[model samples]
Target: SLVPLLKGLKPKWRDSLYYHYFEFPSYHMVAKHFGIRTSRYKLIRFYQFDEWEFYDLEQDPDELSNRYGDPKHAKTIAGLKRQLDGLRTAYKDNSDVRAMPIEWRKKYRPGRE
Candidate 1:
């Protein structure tokens, strides 16, 4: 089941610690969800709800509040979104991602498509 890695290919192994998923079954539901995490942040997007939730580990260590849509975190949020897009592209996890591209996801609102 391991591609690019055979019985003795242990040394070339790489870590998939940065990977994230569409939360299968949950992704097909009325409210689709996709999440991504890096060392300093965690971002979750609720597709049907057009909501985004993100936390900054450096500032809010307790995660008591989400900084998403907060003006202070705009740049950070954009950067994270780009990373998430790259991950999804590399993994080819979903076929319809282009319909809801990362750029559109960033601009989406509850009232808008």
Candidate 2:
């Protein structure tokens, strides 16, 4: 946790962070996605849409361009994908939609008809 760092304990710095967002195209029309952020790169995966995005923070801080399948960043993307999987396993996030509350499914899920 950041508590140690916040308390001035000089904890080892973290090189990356993991995030998962499960909000469908509900209120803001933002799709559900997950990502990992490092100091130099950010990778996002929109699972339901089968889409992926990667960005070089130094070059594209605004995240306008996607480098997910770029040949130049192939190795980097592979490494990030590995790290993403590790993070998911560590956090025990199986990405199971059944874990969401029924009401939440009815309200936030994109299609319910």
Candidate 3:
């Protein structure tokens, strides 16, 4: 791991990181989404909402702009998606958010119609 590299040995580094947040009726009103991030880019899919977001970490580090449908980055986004799928399979994450237990809904998202 990074320990080997830190100790003056070679350690193979990964090219990307995968992230998933799947809390519906979220405490902070954040949508459920999954994403993959590399050193230079990040791609997110808000599956339940049918939305996709992408960012160029180099140019838009704040993620102020979404480049998902931008023609110039189509190829890059496609490659990232493939890598994301691979990560999902490797991690055995189905990328589906199961329903929260009813009691949790009452605790976390109470008083909603």
Candidate 4:
């Protein structure tokens, strides 16, 4: 159950972990796999370290989250990096998936950042 999985987690840990690893990606993958689209702007945006990210799953499903700049989630972010790397290597995804420049202020908005 969710409780067992999230046991012993601090409230903030639970919030970030669930949001990054489970809730957001789950929603993104299911929607894209079925070709479902929403009018409410389904972009996933997060600030990890210092930079911001914007992912449009209609274009990229494998890359569901941006963990480039968030130090708070460093370990979680690193694990995700390894996971993504393995998946990419397994599928022979040679395309450079490295972070690219984005209008941080515009995409994630100022107050939110």
lDDT value, residue 46 of candidate 1: 70
Candidate 1, TM-score vs. the true structure? 0.57
Q: By descending lDDT, how would the candidates be arranged?
A: 2, 3, 1, 4
How high is each candidate's TM-score? 0.57, 0.77, 0.78, 0.29
Candidate 4 global Cα RMSD: 14.2
lDDT digits (tens) for residues 6-108 of candidate 3: 8999777798999888676656777788999999999998765556899998999999999899999999999999999999899999756554556755564
Best by lDDT: 2
The candidate 4 region of ten consecutive residues with least summed lDDT is 32-41
Residue-pair clash count for candidate 3: 0
C-alpha lDDT of residue 3 in model 2: 88
Stretches > 4 Å off in candidate 3? 1-3, 97-113
| 1 against 2, candidate with superior lDDT | 2
Off by over 4 Å in 1: 1-31, 95-113
Task: Give the per-residue lDDT digits (tens) of candidate 1, residues 1-113.
Answer: 67546665656533222443455345453345676776778787775445678999778878779899799989978988887787777778664432355555445443444
Please estimate how well model 4 matches the true structure, expressed as its whole-model Cα lDDT.
0.37
Across residues 1-113, which tens digit of lDDT does each residue of candidate 4 receive?
46755786544331111122223235343211101112211223232213334333454555566433556656644555455445546656454323324464345334643
Ranking by TM-score: 3, 2, 1, 4
